[model samples]
Target: MNDALGEPQSVLVLGGSSEIALATVNALPRRRLRRIVLAARPSAARDLAVTTLTAEGISGVTAVDFDARSTESHSVFINEIFDAGDIDIVLLAFGVLGDQEAAEADPALAVEIATTNYTGAVSIGLHVARRLRMQGHGSLVVYSSVAGDRARRSNFIYGSTKAGLDAFAQGLGDALHGTGAHVLVVRPGMVRTKMSAGMPEAPMTTDANVVADIVVKSLRRGKETVYAPGPLRFVMAGLKSMPRSVFRKLPR
Candidate 1:
């Protein structure tokens, strides 16, 4: 449940170790948050997240085992969490940005990306939606990307997965409308994080904290869709409207 100020009191982050997700948690009103659950695969990173939040004086921070690719376990995982109490916010932030050339060379690698990014999201997203609907008040913040707006040749496989995720999230938001549950789809541009480490910076590339700030603001404003740095919306619009031939010739 949210506090009197309309701030979330409990947050469940699906990708516990995600830099952007952790940043969003840090940016929230700590005094209002009672419980913070970091759900990710058991790892040192997961442990570090708990310690980091604890160091920030977030009292009820804890980590739970969660594997995005384990679709069959999602329902049970979600139910167990909700059984403890109501969740005020659920952040679906797990994903993989595989090497484009490697994915192109290995079909198996491409399938892995699709399964983790798209299929797994669908699996857990539905479960989370059901719980939110049952609670009658909450928000689901989905981390989409501008790449989904229009698939480019350089990263079409990853872009395609985000495309499916963005659409699914939109439709889910519609379904949850009037049920007192809302969804915020965050489409961040190139964000500098461990995931994008060593990659060449692209135009409008920003930091995870920048994306986190945008997400927090969007949640406060009850926005359904938002672009980090706020300018990429227009950029993506132009790219989306460009002709395929022209788009194909553009630099990666």
Candidate 2:
């Protein structure tokens, strides 16, 4: 599974500390990857991520501070990466799960969710896409969710954020349709990741490893969209068709 440059040596993950993102990277051929750039906010948690990747045999690991709110600096951040060389792949995995209640109380909170989940990602990703296109190839994997299919009252704020991200990724995919660069939009059902640790688990909940495996397979196959656990595609279809009144009543 060596890439053209001797191996899939260089990789970039925007939310390098994300559990799902980390799982996906681990699932990749470690022997083929020489370096992994993990961009995340500085915190004790991110420091632990560096140690974990190092323990997993990912030797060339670098952590850079990236604030999703600072969309203006996204270009500079990406330029720094390309200044080195063509990155094998870039995963836009950064996002925040805002408290639904808080968002409802304060519109600013909702705006924050939208900015972090959608605007910030798209800003940086579009830049990366252009770089990949110019270089003639690379993979961009964006994390969307089934909740984006239809906004549910239980989690409409979060759902809406995903909806925007899903749409942005799709449009980006189309815009780069003929370019050698490609985009993969991943929709996974509820998972027990740290993001949703306190929430009750949902049906067909998958592990981070499962999501990672699907992403890898999707990239290999050049799939435009992938649903984790696979069956979620149909599940979401049925859920989306359900009456809103009924949908809202269903226990999450």
Write down the lDDT of every candidate, Cα atoms only: 0.92, 0.86
- Output the number of the lDDT-best candidate: 1
Where does the lowest 10-residue lDDT sum fall in candidate 1? 25-34
What's the CA RMSD of model 2 in angstroms?
A: 1.9
lDDT of 2 by residue, 67-96 (tens): 888989988999998777778778899988
Which runs of model 1 end up more than 4 angstroms from their true locations?
A: none
- lDDT of model 1, residue 88: 94
TM-score, cand. 2 vs. native: 0.94
TM-score of each: 0.98, 0.94
Judging by TM-score against the true structure, name the best candidate: 1
lDDT, candidate 1, 1-252, per-residue tens = 786676788999999998899888877776678799999988788899899888877778999999889899999999999999999999999999988899999999999999999999999999999999998999999999998999989999999999999999999999998899999999999999999898899999999888988888888888999999799999998988999999999998
